[model samples]
Target chain A: MKIEEFSSDHLDVLKELMNIAMGNATASIADLLQAFGTMHIPHLTITDMDGLKSQINHTISADEKYYVTKQLFGGIIGGEFIFVMTDESAANLGHYLYDVSQPSDADIMDAVIELTNILSSTIISRLTEELNTKVQFFAPSTQIISGNHIIGQDETLNYHKIIIVSTEMEFQSHKISGYIFILARDETITRLRELIDQKLEELYA
Target chain B: MKFLVVDDSKLARLSLIKTLKEYEPTAECIEAENGAVAVELFKAESPRVVFLDLTMPVMDGYEALKLMMQIDSNAQVVVVSADIQTQAQVQVLALGAKLMVPKPINSDKMLGILQQLVF
Candidate 1:
């Protein structure tokens, strides 16, 4: 779907949905670590592969170390849910999760997986639920890598036309922050636009 | 009458409950956060109508729908989800769900279903 096709009202719905989703994520994470957190209003973009790369690179600088986790979900619609965190932020988050000043290597890995699970369930699940559709996530996988290559390495993903939904997540107590991206495939993006249009019509008409 | 509403998100459940109350004011509403807990409540309460969410942890909606049907073949289960693909609609219907409503719930449609299916 063309991003232009979505009116301000449609984008409002998406932002509201993301706000609710990430709000839950922040609250749950806060509960787990006994820390305060903030979730920004999500931003959306309709772009191509090159544009995606440009956007991602801007979000993560070249020298930054990152933890990237991605999971595929499908049912009425299908897409990828990706979570990105810088090295410093990831370390802070890990410390909070493990409740240790110096976490073991295994502790770091486990914390990442647990955090991913909670977020994938909380954020993406809420987004889909608000859309009135169900999505089942396939297995989630992660990689620890430097920032410059995050988007460039994934050639398997269809990037012809992607709908990108992103939000900033911050844990104030731990001084940790991260980004969450939900990439709706072109087909799913088209369907989402159609559904939003339908909803708008019902509301106005 | 009693109704069981299952969704993992607290906000979603509350939204669903609001719409449900508008339609069936007298029905007592019960909530569950996941499919597994939903099944337990379904068995324990034998609610007149069940509004189910499809994507959840512990037990997803498909498994919960199947288990609820097994518990009572005549279960009046409604599938409310964001994934409203034709295949999903057919699959859930085949498994005994009465209807599937697409998300951001359409109040008029939901009320119509309450009149048709619940009564």
Candidate 2:
């Protein structure tokens, strides 16, 4: 099914669920830093690679340096979760989590990976559970790179579409606002709709 | 005069409390981060009403609701979650939720529940 074929009801459900999942993720970051965080209303969309990149670039250019983290998950459906932030934001986060104002490069990377692992796993696992599907995720990996390096990967899943589920998270006491995303494969979109429809039947019908 | 709100998000819990305050200015609220803590709070405080989130770490709402039932079968639980799909609602109802309230809650819904729970 084409990405546009996804009904508004299905998209709404995904958005609502994503809001909570990402809220949980933001809470993890808060606990990591011992500070409160605020979650922006999530932006939910479905598009091809070019559109996805364009949407992201509308806010921050791809060429800008960003700390990118990635994790892969598989089960009834599969997808990649990507977290992005400016280099300065990453450093601020790392410093806060490490309790140092000027952490070394290695310390920053360690903070990034540990932070990403917690945030990514929490969001994806919460989302999958809410959707009533079991999923398994591998260890997360992080790098200080550009956003282009993230959406620029080639996939062998034979899927031409991705569900771009994203939100901006900001620390209440800190000046760090970053992006968190879940790019679900084409097949995963179909499966998600099926599960949602089944859920609709059980609740409304 | 007491309510228990269980959610992993501190922001969300605060939001719920804000809404609950509209109708229950004097009602006491106890917060829990997960189902395990929720069960413990239910034992310690015995709040008259509960607002439970279904997808939480440690133990999910389903298990929490079941255990709460075992402890106090009369507990009035309103399942609060973003996962309000029909299957989710049915499951929570089967697990013994009095009603299901989706996340991003507002005052009207909370006032309604407060009216029912209080008077």
Candidate 3:
């Protein structure tokens, strides 16, 4: 079934699964940074490229410069993971990750990519394990860009429907925050829906 | 006893309620989709205890706990949120929550929380 065909029960179960996955990533990042952090509840939506862009733009301000990272994962269930963080947050992350007073640009880039890797792998692995599936992740790419351009204006989205599972991670003491978006489309959505259905059957049984 | 379970996800609320039932077979539950609704229900239902989730749309558990305490100083609130940061736990407790436990509550954890409550 397509994303629009998802029942309320399916959406609810998927959301709870995302919550558990994101929570695991939050704890992992907290340990890496040696700081306590909070992860917001996951927001799941089915939209096209334009709608996804609009949602991201609404959540992230257009005034700041951000470090945007993207990673692709493929298997029975596959998707793209996008992470966006403010430039200032990236710098703070460098200091927190590398313990440097004034980290150079290389330090910032390295830290951002590493952080993205940790978040993507932790969240995807946890989610896949729960769904009884496995995935292989590709190397992530990072770029410094304006917040407005964090999500590229590529209208050439391959799929007619996109499933976006997004959340925010914040560290109060470090004043660091980031947004994570997991996008899946095409056949993956069908597989995911089936898995969610199986989970629902188990829940109701 | 009557319990109030608050969460944006119906699955979460259902799971918590099921575990609560396992702990107390005859217990009654009232569900709220967010902290705003939880507050309204709190005033109307006066549930014996509340199991709250911190990150919810419209309103969050922290605000709800603060408001609940203001309305009834003796309110019993246990935050069951995925945000397990130390700061989050301390903040909820400072706002007068009886305790803050992580999400996906099972029967044993529910039993522990129920036993920890005086009334």
Candidate 4:
């Protein structure tokens, strides 16, 4: 089925599934940081690469430098998770995760990668478990960009249409926030549609 | 037998209302898309119990809970949200929430919540 063919029932089920998965992931993050965090409702959208770029533009402002992390998860339903956080947010993460008042550059990168792994692995793992699928995660990479340098500029993502599952996570007390984008392209979209269909069937039946 | 169901997602509202009806078949449920409307409904309708979601557009559950408590100290609001952080739980309880549970409320969980309610 085409991405546009997704019905309201399908989107609702998908959003609920995301809520459950993200709930579990947020608990893990809270435990890791020993702090409280809030997750926004998961937003599902089907868009081209340019549209994805536009969303990133809308989410991550051009005024501040950001440390963007990307991790790929592969299997029948494979996709990449992109996490974007401002430089100050990254530093705050380092401090909170490691209790370092003045975290170095390496400290910031390490903290970002660690946080990304926790967020992506817990979320995707729970989501796949609900879908009855298995996935393998690759090492994550981080890049520092400022002033109009978006994260999705990689030439490899040339798909005509992609599914973007996006959310925002915030630790209000710590003043740290990040935007997470999970991109599923081509075959992955088809697989997601099938999985969602099965889920809807189970729910309605 | 009046209850307020507040969530931005129609699916969540439907799911919760469906589960709730199994326990209280004659329960009247009022729905709201966001916290702003929820507060208004709480003021006007005065639902016996409220099932609120934390992460929403316009206003969030935290502010809504605070307002509801200010309007009526005895208001019963159960926070159903994706944010399961311990601090979130503490924050809501401190704000006078009756209970804080996670998303996707099923029949069994709904029964437990209802059984615990004093009203």
Candidate 5:
């Protein structure tokens, strides 16, 4: 199962799943922040490993791409969930929570962590119940990326297949984007296909 | 009993204090804006029990718990947060936190936990 082939076949279903997951996350955040906000998840697209690497390298300037938050979870559905947001986004979220009209860059890091904590937990909870499995989420790790650093590159080339789901969030009219990548083990693809098929059947039936 | 409550949000801390006061009139409560200050208060005052928020600036509840345990392993810490997910709840419990209480601080639930911990 090549990355492109898998993405082409499953992108729509993956997008729908992400929408459901993120909707719950968005609501949870709104309740926590005591502010009403809306989440808009654009179409899901599969980005090949090479494409993702290039995109990340190009989007972040060498000096600016230093910090990242990575969380991994496993259960009936297993994957490496990654959220890449600029320092600006983090501050923006924090300021929004504080009801500040304009948030300064100083506040973004804390805001980013808070937002990530709430969003990640909400998504994991939804995934656990939907998949009917005991999902475990590790503590999130913050890392510094210098220049064009690529993740999951050192592993066996066989696991290059990645499923990318992009989420855009609007809070207090401020917009931020979050990305979740489902990196499937070689044997896991068949199981995912079965799950998707079952979901489709339930949706139609 | 004396209780020290730590949370980054002023609103949340205020609400918790209000609820505690309502549930236990004689409860002497102190407040800290973040986990680090809470730890400092814990070492200085050694309150009977502490109500800690999981998310905050400077130091989060988990880090504060590690520091408090190092100071006194028998410290009683209860986590209060809006994050009620099973994974987070399990992780906090596994870390030796006495109880995981969800937010919006239902009066009955808060009183129930307090009664168990206090009495």
Candidate 6:
């Protein structure tokens, strides 16, 4: 599955919408941390299943591995939203928010969970409003591991193309990045495509 | 009465504005993208109260607080941020901020603070 399924205009709208969504996420995070900070909206990219796998692998290096938190939301718009943060980035965010000279592993874990909650909630809210759909989100589950853990073989699992959008944030002097991935079934994708087309037509007209 | 809100995020600013409207319907609300503009606006408008975000580009909350203090020692400036740690809270408190509120701006908490400062 290629991102070409959606028109450039659709992608543009999605990107803009995600920018606002990500901003909300950071704002909620800032509120949660009680720290004054700014979030820079990162670039968004659309990728196929293979592309996503490679992207995930490339993002997690030997020195800096990725921590992923997965949450399922059901209702008007339903799908899995995954937020990926680098271990180093998570530590920096924790220290910055807490105003601590150093951060503990527990601090990093707590921050990741909190940050994921904010991002997921904000994105889901925005998506629902823009799509004019009613959706529900389930509890978020998290995984923190090395890059090798992500790349290890798991033949039993079924694979589908995922839409990944990334945003970079700087909070309290810490540089952190956020990723939102929507894993959809084929039927869901069809509905999403129709929604995108309708939105694009409205935008252009 | 007029109020000034300072934050770098558009969404936060929007959220804050929406919440403030419920509390102060007739109060005029103004916004600044960062602390520097916030200080400038404070000097020009002398708003009844100021909602300030601590971390911002060009100038941060501490510097902005110092500037506001130098301009108007009795300024009613409230620190609004997401960082809730004890040290950060104490640091802002020491900077002469009248009060500190966490982010997402709870309506009840905000009304309490507003009632204490403005009423």
Predicted candidate 1 versus true structure: per-residue lDDT over A37-60, tens digit per residue: 643546888887877888888888
Error in Å for residue A102 of model 6: 6.9
Docking band of candidate 6: incorrect
In order, the interface RMSDs are 11.7, 12.3, 1.5, 1.6, 15.0, 7.7
The Cα error of candidate 6 at residue A22, in Å, is 1.2
**Candidate 5: segments with Cα more than 4 A from true spot:** A1-9, A36-38, A46-48, A57-63, A94-111, A144-147, A150-159, A172-185, B1-119
**All candidates: TM-score:** 0.61, 0.64, 0.89, 0.89, 0.50, 0.55
Tell me the deviation in Å of residue B70 in model 2. 42
In model 4 chain A, the worst 10-residue window by lDDT is A147-156
Q: What does the lDDT read for residue B46 in candidate 6?
A: 95
Tens digit of lDDT per residue, candidate 6, span B21-97? 77878979889978899988999999989898766668877789889989998989998865444555787788888
Better of 3 and 5 by TM-score: 3
For candidate 1 chain A, which ten residues in a row score worst on lDDT? A196-205
DockQ (0 to 1) for model 4: 0.58
> In model 2 chain B, which range of ten residues has the least summed lDDT?
B82-91
Scanning candidate 3 chain A in windows of ten residues, the lowest lDDT window is A151-160
Give lDDT tens digits, candidate 5, residues A1-205: 4333453325555544454566567667666665445445334434456755665565456556544667777766676666666555565566676667776544565566667777777776765565455667787775546545536547446335555555555555465544444444444455566665565454434
Q: How well is candidate 1 docked (DockQ)?
A: 0.02
Which has the higher TM-score value, candidate number 2 or candidate number 3? 3
Candidate 1 docking quality: incorrect, acceptable, medium or high: incorrect
Pairs that clash in candidate 2: none
Q: Report residue B14 deviation for candidate 3 (angstroms).
A: 1.3
TM-score of chain B of each: 0.95, 0.95, 0.96, 0.97, 0.94, 0.95
Give per-residue CA lDDT, model 2, range B6-118, as digits (tens): 98766567668877876778979999989999999999999999999876668888899999999998889998876534555677888888888777678888877767766
